[model samples]
Target: MTVLTDKPESPFYEQLSGIVDEQILHLQDARGIFLLDKAHERYMRYYLRNVAEKPWNNHLLLSALVYVDKNADVRTIDELLQQVNVRLVDLFKIFHLSNMAEFNVETHMYQYLKGSYYQEHSDSMRSKLLALYRSLTYSTRKWVTSKLNSDQQSYFEQYLLPMPSYDSRDFSFTKSAKDLAKDTRKNETDVIVPLLPQIRAEGHFRWNQINRLRQTFLKACEQAKTTSMDLPLEFHYDEPERVGERFYFRLWDKSSFVLNHHDQFSASSLTSAYKRTGAYSEGNNRYFVEFVKAERLDDDEKAEGLWFTEIFEKGLIGRWNEFVDVTDDLIQQKRELLYSWGYGKNDFTENSFPFFSKHKGILTPSTFVSRNKHLAEGILFDVEPLYAAVTFGLLAVDIFTTTGARINELLQISNTRECIRKVKVEDKLKFSFYAIPKGRDEVEPFYISEQTMKLIQLVAKFLKEHYGTDKIPSVIYRGNRSHLFPEPKPYFFQYHESSFNHFAVGACLRFLLHGLNFESQEGKPVVIKTHLLRHAFATEAVQRQNLPIDIVAKILHQRDIEVTGYYSEPTPSQVAQSVSDLHDVISDYVDLDEAVLRSGEELVNELEEYKQKVGVFNNVLGGACTTNFVCPTKMQCLGCQAKVPQPEKKHELEEVIELSKDMEKRFTEMNLPVEVKKAKAMRKHARNELKEIELIEKYREEQKYEPHIQFKK
Candidate 1:
């Protein structure tokens, strides 16, 4: 064995001194609310009460004290400590101790096997409590720091985190002198023992009865394995603590004990652990409570959150407690945790056990990804553009859809200049879609401008730059005039929120989980997932200058699902530049319909001359000159060929004016039921009148300059 011997300047003792001091202080701080101690206190109390025994020291504590601290060579003792034959604790004056039985004065002898080590537990004080004492309160000084390695210091601190709820004593012991005030027996003046505690109205245990029962249990359950189940433990008789309850054990768990959907303990686990290890189940067991368990904490046993070989030795006749195999217990725990989320072992890993377990690590991508589609995609993630696309896809879909749209839409170009002289959308721009859904005899259309067309060109360039490096399932976009979503692998992200969130949050969580070596998959982790991205998008939708929720919702396929909302609109600055860009396109083409109205007024001024021209050959006949009697000239048209310009209105101009008024009316409609046909007819009338006015105005303008036009008036 490697040993750090004395006489060196920087000796083992000096290095460990600070760490050990800090550890002790931590232990003292843990005196209250530590799960391990709380559990032990309960078991101890229960056993003691059941047996009805009063002993100075507990067997469990003695074993620990003797096992960890003793050095046999430095101290020589005549007393022989035969492990198989040794008693657990012996009286040293009034307090019971294990070393007193193994003590030898001759050579100042103390050996680990001879009782210089401690198991680091008290029947009442917990492992965490003891650890806290060791780390914080154990020292007289208020502050302590670690000189040990960082890992050791971390280990020291971790052991002290409190269980969620304080269940009081693990098992009640007979009311100790500290808990109850002394009272002399009424019949006998000299005899004194604490009275049974006053029972509360509720079923919960009172302090007196709880402590008394705890002690009784320890005694009754002593050597319980080879002995009867009816251990010598019971509460002091007092109104039964309540009407019907026989017992209660304090919870030694994390604060999340009361959270939704947890495991239930049958009280059998305590006995099973103790019987096997002579150590109660604590940190590595159900005792941990609410916090997510770290893989580092996975051990058959832990002392102050440090993994160690938990065994005992005493002389050649050894009585080493067996290691508690929590294999089945852990399996049950994992299954229970998964079940709460509506899944079974069959849902996750093929073996249903995490590949990177406490004892197993060489898990490869194949085994780790296994059958999980979401996980597999996540595993394939790199800094590649596809990674951003897939990961961003989640948030994007929530903000917009393609729920699984690929990058194909960003690639194609259309030459619209070939079809029309003036392109409705820019002729230079081409549009296509990637991962958009298709229908029979129909293809999804993408509205691309020059900017998006450029984005596709960039994607193509990028694909070429990293050609043959594609790790994805397949590439679909290549030629033109096609749907980007090709055959075979249809769904990129399956329809599940957990899978979506997993992709988002799992990025970070998986990384942290992996670093701590959790029994889960590990790779270059993405710290954020899709929903978080969606959350960002949602927040941006509400808080940023993005499109309104309704429009965004429609983009994300949520419009049909929502009800009426009249949210405030944004100022122009907040909108994406694309809206402004589209605005510029429209502003360049000011509606000529309004300008046409102005020209119609001029034509109306010369309307009579045009009437003469149609019949007497002066200038022009404007479809017999339809004129608006609804116009400003309406009163002066008594002998007019057309009293209203509506008489000569063409079909198209009428439609434009009608469309504008209908749009204006919709603003005030607000779910108001109205007849569509009647509304359409009124709109049509407004348009037709405007058109006739335009025609009459044009006819009058022609007579003003034509060869021999003369006004009838």
Candidate 2:
């Protein structure tokens, strides 16, 4: 119903005209909003893929395109926009988008049908809709700005440069305790010791806030019944101290009065009684606090308090978990409650009526709070938070435990062919998770255990069922403004009740740890996070298991070995134990006759050269030893082409041959055909190499001048 008619004389108007010329603003659209054509849509997609990574830039563009007017004067446009209470991208998502299908349009009016059976969309659409909306807006703004002349650009900057901003309070949203540990160069022990308790307290605060709201709602319902009336649309209160007593009051500047009409004989009488409490005035200003229904709540008004309506006429008012009425109707009612929190509403029909929503004019004590938790407490956690915690909790646990992916990399998973692959592992069928890791340029698959694969499938199945789609929906993260492209497709981790993002991912892990009361190996409370799993993986691979650094780097998808070096470092105790063990191996195995040793220094130099050639360690022969060539296989050094024939080291070679034969026998007994084949080949190669070493030792023994190897040494 709101429209800007007739162009005005102003520099801002001229810019608007230029934007219209570029087809960025099509005021002729049904809602007097901008709509994208096929060509423009493609261009926007390209921009989103290549340039605009975050929604902030897109939001600014859309705010200007959707809310700005050509008729407004350049000098007053900023003030006018502020007065209009322009809706943020979050608000637009809640009310404007009914489902994914409607999201592409700039802004479309949605209606609720009477006696309708249409299933409402999932809450996850919030982020999806915003992403697409911002992409369009960002592309449009870029196009408009590019076409601007220097004078027009200067005018645009002066008028629109100061953007509307609000704090999101997302400081702890992205980084997990593990991520912080990596940045601060602290161990998990140090990080978890402090972070775990704080997050646990945060969780408790969140739950308690919800409980208070639910209790208050129930009490208000009881009061309504005592009065023989329907649910109250709004709650008025005097002060925090008297909130328990339920004495309703409204306060004016420097004065306050309680609503004393509850004892009135009839509903009409009570209405008439309170109607006289009109707007109070001081110094040419008058204002009144008005109550409205939740269904009609809009972004324009600031939220005052909650409204408990009869939308749930099923007479269901208790703990959310116990309620069996999961029908579409109940879900819609829940959406209405969220909308009243100044986010967005699911239904915006004319007769919907507000139960919980914002209000105009002066606010009472119950109306104001500093954080979203104050308004969100019971309303949000009641139906969806638990489900989210369970779903994403299991997801985070499995992904980290198995593949050890970074949190952002996990977010990149989608039920697409590119993200998943089936491969054989240890001779058994297993899944290979392929992804382009954070800060990396290439994609590779990391083989995960069967258990991890099953968990991933479970999550994928749930998403498919919940969205009712065969196609996989991609997970996307807005990055720095410079790189705005949507990640290569198929996002697997999505929230069922709200938009999925890194913040949600971290919260899920924290909530999971809180719920499980988990502790670390050091007996400290555990704070599970994405990067911690990465570090754990590296430590196990390079230090504990003695895998190669380059291989560890590849598994972690690191661009260089230096980044992985931090994680792969051995502890002081680990280093000391390794050195002690190596000393024992050398003293037990190295034996040389003084006559053949000729120069002791020459023998030491030869050993040093061999160690340098093999880079100091080779465990495939059962223990660390000097080598002059690379091992040909990933397994033990049984099949190494560069192994030296040392008669004194004959026992180690014999042990390797026996180990290979034993491994092959086990594979055959286990009926692992693929592994049996590999093991059989390794055993055959080890036997041949052992025979050659024995022949060389026999020849040395036959020649009395040549010192023979003594295996007993």
Candidate 3:
């Protein structure tokens, strides 16, 4: 066994210092690396790590180990089994329950677990905790048991096998289809629907404006360099005169004016010039020219009223201390000016520059200038924050609503131009992006519209240019910066400083919704959760657009089509409409041509009497049986001519056809001639029924027929 000393410099050292036992740290995995070392570096970074929440899977696992037996040196699967005994489930329960209780001291865990409370933490918190415990235990057990010897594995199976089910035994309360739809619309869809167009428009506008400013700045700078003009050359003809009431600082400078120790002008002289004209230093020899309005200026000060534009010029004033002194004097003078102008000095303090602190790194209005409306008119303050919010917010909404991408998959989208691919489908091309779905190692193509692909590419280009990097910076997923991805991928959905992880993207989305002031049908303010957008997408696809459930499942990257069914549950109105449409389709199927039946009145009466005589029984494949007494063909409605197929059940018929084909192939391989013949007959019947249903649907689509004859059974 390799004896390893704890490295204090390790990032995990602090988190593990108090919670983990020293003996546990000494334990080794199948590899020579210490268990704690592996846990800190590699184990938690695996696919099981919870992306939606904080990176605490390793911490929780270590805590559980310590709780089981701090002194037990659990080196192998057998040893862990011996340590945990048959109390593995109990151990996790105690750990999670205690943790939840401690975190939520106000609520009683016993009551919460037993379903007494109606607060947010009642059902969801319990469910999440149970899921977390189950996931952690399964993952840890799999990792340990994989390296065990045959005899040891057998020993584990015999004694401590059949892991206790953590499935919450409490009564499960499920929402009805109507209730689910109502809740979803009131909470998620309605909120997002109103805000989407607004966000898209605003985001697009801001993006265009940012690009315009960038282009104008580049051109003005080039012009200044070529012309050899004095500092602060204004361009009145090219750019917009105002961005509201504020004038644009269309001035250009070839190089920053530096006032070093050898310069003739002192910091005091620059401060005096700034007091008369709204000008201040923006460190690194850069300064912003504020175009203050004439109304704010003193009568004695013979200076043009200037307001501060977002554009900054590279020009130095003095040393750090001198600059600070100048700023302090200016602040004092501004306060006196405000006080003399009947405004309170307390309202215009250093802290009032919230915009500057909120957006520190990005280009924003100068921090030195007060953001009071009276002081600066039409100045684009909070430019970067608004830009980031609107632009990123729209990108996230568009991607989520359009592609039905989970938050994690959306965040991990590669920044490369090749991320979005175009594949030729017959005569036309379709666009898709490759993303690693949750719980899967392999990547899947998420097909998106051409328009959405263009939007993503535009955002990617802007991000690359803004960061001045060839690619967007690599994002650290869940704080496991090293082991999350095989290599650093420049994730597209990120800010300059950090990636827009689940929480950040959520915050961005909420920020956009908050501005819209949209209200739900419940007459409450709209608050949208990001994941609900996925549900909305699925629901819309299945219920409104009538897309197949299997197709939606594939788009959502769900392995189970049943899960997709839960997402796209039809509302009551939808169910009624589907029933009505099915009635119409059935009626159309039974309709006789007037051209063939010349005795119309007698034929109609006979048809009505015939419909009453036939019995309608619900068949297995969502069709109705017209047999009066019993199913003479032993419920094989597919081959029966009396079986009336429903439009909504078309997918079920298709699935049956596929299953029959598979069975026929399997029977042939087994040399069962009788079974193969039966399977082939079943497949043919299902195909014929499906084709008839398609023709009926086509007839219904081509001709809108009001229900003239009502059939009763």
Each model's lDDT comes to 0.25, 0.39, 0.45
lDDT for residue 254 in candidate 3, whole number 0-100: 10
lDDT of 3 at 295: 32
Among the numbered candidates, top lDDT falls to 3
Model 1: how far is 500 from its true place, Å? 13
List runs of model 2 lying over 4 Å from the truth. 1-186, 189-384, 423-428, 474-488, 496-499, 515-526, 571-713
TM-scores for all candidates: the values are 0.19, 0.34, 0.49
The digit string of per-residue lDDT tens for model 3 on 1-713 reads 22456553445545555544344445444344444443324332321233102223233444333322222211222233322322333333444643321333223333445555434343444554444444445654664466555654454332122233334554252223334545656355544432333344343433444434344445555665576665554432121222222224433211222221115345664554444333433232232332323231223533222212221111111111123333666656554543332223344663112112122233233343222212222332333444455456667776776557887678667754345444332322334577667546567876554345556655666677678876567765432222235455677666665655455576556544433445555555545556677776666556654556776777689889998988876633332011011111112101112223336575456346434533332344736543333344455555442344556678987888789889999999999999998888777766755655554464444333221211111
Q: lDDT tens string, model 1, 1-713?
A: 11323222222223323333323322212223211121122222333333112221222222221221221110111111121112223213223344433333221211221234443323232222222222222221212233334554454443221222222232232133213211111111111000000000000112223223333333333433344333211222212211222222221222112121123322454444444332233333222101111122223432121010010011000110111323555445554543332224434342222212111111111221121112111121112221223222222221121111122222221222111111111112122232222112233433223322332233233333333332212333222122222332312221211112222222222221211211112221222222222222332233232334553443232334232121212222232111100000111211123323445455445454333432211111112212211222222221122211223334444554556467557744755345554455445544434533443343333223212111111
lDDT, candidate 2, equals: 0.39
State the weakest 10-residue window (summed lDDT) of model 3.
Answer: 576-585
Going through the candidates in the order shown, the clash numbers are 108, 20, 10
TM-score between candidate 1 and the true structure: 0.19
At residue 482, give the lDDT of candidate 1.
26
